[model samples]
Target: METSQTHENSIKLTSTEDGIHLDGSILWLDSKHTGDISFLSNPQSATSKLDSRVIATEETIRILESFRKKPKALICQYNRPFAIGPLNMELLPSGVGLGGASLWVETNNKKILYAPQLQPQNSETCHHMQVRKADILILSAKTPYNADANISRKREKERLIETIKKMVSANERPQIFCEPYATGPEITKILSEEGINVAVHPNLFRILKVYEAYGSHVGSYIQHSIHRGDYDTLLKPIPQNKQLRRVFPKNPVISIEDNQGPRLDDGLFRKIDERFYIPSSCDGRELKTIVPKIKPREIYIFGPYAKDYVRQLRSLAPVVKALFPRHLPSLF
Candidate 1:
């Protein structure tokens, strides 16, 4: 446990066997934790098995219904302040995926912001990330410091559209594999705006319906059908089986993978005509730019590559600490 003096009082920050604790409240940022009150940050966290009073954004609660997993969750809207005991908490858009948010808590003249999966970039299907000054900032350090971090999502989207056009022109069916919750909706919205016919997997279709309910313009899409052969493009999750060639033998297969996950081996899909990569997430360079704007008095890094993030942010923040869990508790 670490104690920091605030204007009129002191704030307690600690990581215990349960999870990250701010004062006495427990935070479940896309992780499961046990406490009286568990503040969830995103859809992933809301659906987690948590034996506590769960609180999440309104969108997240709706998404949970789509998954058919109901937990008694207290709903709150973005930028709206709600009280839980002595803490005044508000949700801010995290800009990572659908229904993603950052938690901001204020108590005793001190403010703390918890954002585990933050992306400052705007998406066509989701809200832009909102930043605010805080006394303490707990951030995730998952993005690697590399050249791929600098790739522009705008250019990548354009490139993906062009490639899909070329594949269609050559009488090939372009199958795009992406993460269902994060990149799927954005890509679908972009392709739909371009007037391209897109078919999504059943699970993704359910999620898109939730997004539509929240007023996100995901455009027009049909659920993927094994019998239908009219769509120009097909969007689905990464396949566990490599023998996809046998399933769609009528059209020449060209797979365009969203580089959000592991790269598929060439031998796994020998029949694939071509493959392309499009990655997402806020990189190390962007994190540096975002932190200064937030103007946090103290910063704590957690998640993958915590040491690297700590080193990079040490000079930018007044006090930078790494919260790498020794017992592998899911702090993020």
Candidate 2:
């Protein structure tokens, strides 16, 4: 095995054919890693958009094969942990959306945290629950470099509300195009409680329906339509009360549609003076504050974010840029 020990008790991680090769064991981080591009048919429609990028589902689930060794335990309630070879690999749940996991590998009493894509909402209880001290930390470098990372979820929610209010005052009802998976439902939940009319694309609505069945209060407010004005085949499950009907007419309506057209440079986003806000969870600036708390001994950054931009993290630990080939199985 190829190895690089840059720090005491540190080991360079590497990609293996089956999983991320750590100390005497292999850890599979994602659900599947078949590297099958053909499964990504109609790339735009099949995947969730994170800024300009799209993550296809079929590509995500490389295949339906079972794990060579099933997970032996669950972590933080949502994550899965497996004992492989000499290492204990724990899959930590991501805060970005409904389902994703970051890898936490341990071997020889050394702990390594690998967060390739993580953007937890500040208000989420699990946000702080995921943080832990580690010997090595790996982060994705593909965050919006220019945007301030410290922007709190509360501030963003308030900014969105303010933007929508300004649009309503201008006598325009805003139609929003929301990515089905890239964006979380926090903002949508707030808009619903404010009595704003919110409609979602049928496909996206179906996903929210599942969330509703699971007892999510916000799912009750999302309508199964492209917009309030559009025709919908699905019958409204709940009886519409007079007060509920009045919300759409009295307030500027917000619609969540799956990509209807090609995305512009900024993609579907908040336009100047426009009545919509496209919320994406791709921003990683929150890490600037959170990582210091974890206080890992060494850090590796892997995404499109520049090395210089992540250098600010050096103050917390020894930071390094480790970009791996797309097809490579591991980063060490």
lDDT (Cα atoms) of all candidates against the true structure: 0.71, 0.44
- Encode model 2's per-residue lDDT on 183-256: one tens digit a residue: 43444566666656566545556555544443445523445544456321122211112112322333333432
Give one digit per residue, the lDDT tens place, for model 1 in 81-180.
Answer: 8887778889898886777888888887878888877777678688898878888888866545442555666777888888888878888777776766
Q: What is the lDDT of candidate 2?
A: 0.44
Cα-based TM-score, every candidate: 0.85, 0.62
Alpha-carbon deviation at 156 in model 2, angstroms: 3.5
List the pairs of residues colliding in candidate 2.
13-332, 14-332, 15-330, 141-303, 141-305, 142-305, 149-285
Residue 272 alpha-carbon offset, candidate 2, angstroms:
7.6
TM-score of 2: 0.62
lDDT of 1 at 199: 93
Report per-prediction Cα RMSD to one decimal.
4.1, 10.1
